[model samples]
Target: MLKRLVSAWVWISTGLIALIWLPWMGLVWLFTARDPGRYSVGRWFRLAAVTVTRLNPFWKFRTTGVQIHDPRRPYVAVANHESLADIFLLSHLPWEMKWMSKDTIFRIPVMGWMMRMAGDVMVIRGDAGSRMRALEEARDRLRKRVSVMIMPEGTRSGGGELLKFHDGAFRLAIETGSPVLPIALAGTRHAIAKGSWLVGRARAIARVLPPVETAGMTLDDVPALREKVRTMIAEARTVLQRELAAAGA
Candidate 1:
């Protein structure tokens, strides 16, 4: 009960901060429209996330297994999705990357506007043509030197374990001839589990594995690469869950 109470207060306080900062963020974006790279809106996002996680002190993060990069090549980062906190955590990735998210989220007032100004791609999931359009948009973004990130699971899993993988992310990487960067995010499930409003102070680990080369790979490679990523994430999830369970508070 006390944990839940503290979590509620934290969420409320964060919401209040967003109410204030989001508008100012929008204004900043407008003034710097031509200089998106000059000012990183991601800094503001990371600050907010770090503040919330640090508020409880117990909430911590650990990352590992990130592959060496060329820094010149564009990649489609594919990962398993498990919670809303995934967004903030993923933003903490080393590179300054853009996201591909649902179209509906881009409709939110200041938040959505900021995302648009940041060169993020919004996709309508159901409409056939919309998916293709989203891919094209992502390719264009990559051509402009932006790495595109997508959650291949599409939606959060019921538990810490991964769900089915969607071929879309893989297909996008293949179509664009960009590398497929596979990441396994553990600990987020315990921090803020799926289908729940409650939050916890558990330390989360986001492990970035090696990137799979997609260049010169045909459509036939998608299925095998997808399975490899899925297995990697599943193993990471199991290891994380066991560690967390053993360290009972």
Candidate 2:
């Protein structure tokens, strides 16, 4: 009962903020033509979402590990998707990365407008052409020295187990000669289930691992590269689970 009430209040505040931010974003976009990645505009948008997760007393979120500091280095950032809450945790990362969101998300009202103004890429599933277009956009961002983020699993693994990783992110890394950055997420599976209104108490942690260089990798090396990242994330997730357990989470 308490959790539900907190969720209700949080959603109200979050929605209100999103509604207000839409116009603000539009005004800003008009001036800067949407600032580049990791700029003030994008960071403000990320923090807006972080407000929702932080205001919830029932959830504890933390992000560990360091990102590459080279301003000219871009990577294909991939993470294991566990829940929508995972997004909030990701926004907590120090630098900004372009989110490869689904088309349906970009079709929403105020929320969608904010995402667009913030320069996120929209991907339409099952449409090969749309996917290709989205990939091109992501590639463009990477070339601009801005990282692109994708979930290799494509969807949340509700059972709290790793899913079969896809090859798109790997292919993107190799094709662009960008490194692959793996982020392992733990304790987010039940934070906010897809079809539920009640928020679950969770201790979520996002661990960003070192980048796997793909300087000379080719298409034939994608399979091996994919497994290598998945394995690294899996091991990190295991260690995070232990840490959460040790903390009584």
Candidate 3:
């Protein structure tokens, strides 16, 4: 009962923070219209969520090995999606990247407004036209030297595990000749379970692994590239789960 009450407060706190932070971001949008990357403004938006993570006593999140010397050097950043909390975990990353999320997320009132203001890309699942358009938009972000973040799994797993990979992210990387940046996320599955509103206690970590350059890769290489990155993320996720478990113990 106590945990649930704290979780309730955490969610409420997140909502309140969003309400308070968004107005300032709206004002920022006016001046940053030409800067679609909106990197600085987006940073402020994510910091609001970071504030929630700090308020929640039952959740702990951190990042490791993310040293982007040139923040403008674009790469296709991919991660294994464990839960909704994965977004919060990645928010801990230092540099700003335009997130590729579902269109449903872009329809939310204030939250969706932030997504648009941040120049994030959104797609409808199973809609061919939407997928193509979203891909083109993501390519544009990369061309502008803004990294794009995507979850190849497309949906959250029940635990800190991966699903069958999709070709979109890898294909984009190869098409644009951008390197593939894999980030391994663990323990977030405990933060928020599938199809539930209640938050759970968790210690999550997002580990940025080395980048795999796709200088000469083509569409035929997407399959191999996709599995290679998936394997890399899976292995790192295994290590992170152990570290999180040991710390909790």
List clash counts for every candidate, in order.
0, 0, 0
Off by over 4 Å in 2: 34-38
Using TM-score as the measure, name the better of candidate 1 and candidate 2: 2
Q: What would the per-residue lDDT of candidate 3 be over residues 50-135, giving only the tens digit for each residue?
A: 88899988888889975889988999999999999988889988888889999889998889988888888999999999999999
Residue-level lDDT of model 2, residues 98-153, one tens digit each, is 89999998998888888877778899988889888988999988977788899989
Model 3, position 116: C-alpha lDDT score: 85
Instruction: Mark the 10 consecutive residues where model 3 has the least summed lDDT.
Output: 153-162
lDDT minimum window of 10 residues, candidate 1: 36-45
In angstroms, the error of model 2 at 184 is 0.5
Q: Tell how far residue 64 is off in model 2, in angstroms.
A: 0.5
Indicate the TM-score of model 1: 0.83
Off by over 4 Å in 1: 27-39, 56-58, 67-72, 243-249
Better of 1 and 3 by lDDT: 3
Error of 3 at 209 (Å): 0.3
lDDT of each: 0.73, 0.85, 0.89
Estimate the lDDT of model 3.
0.89
lDDT of 1 at 57: 45
- How many steric overlaps does candidate 3 have? 0
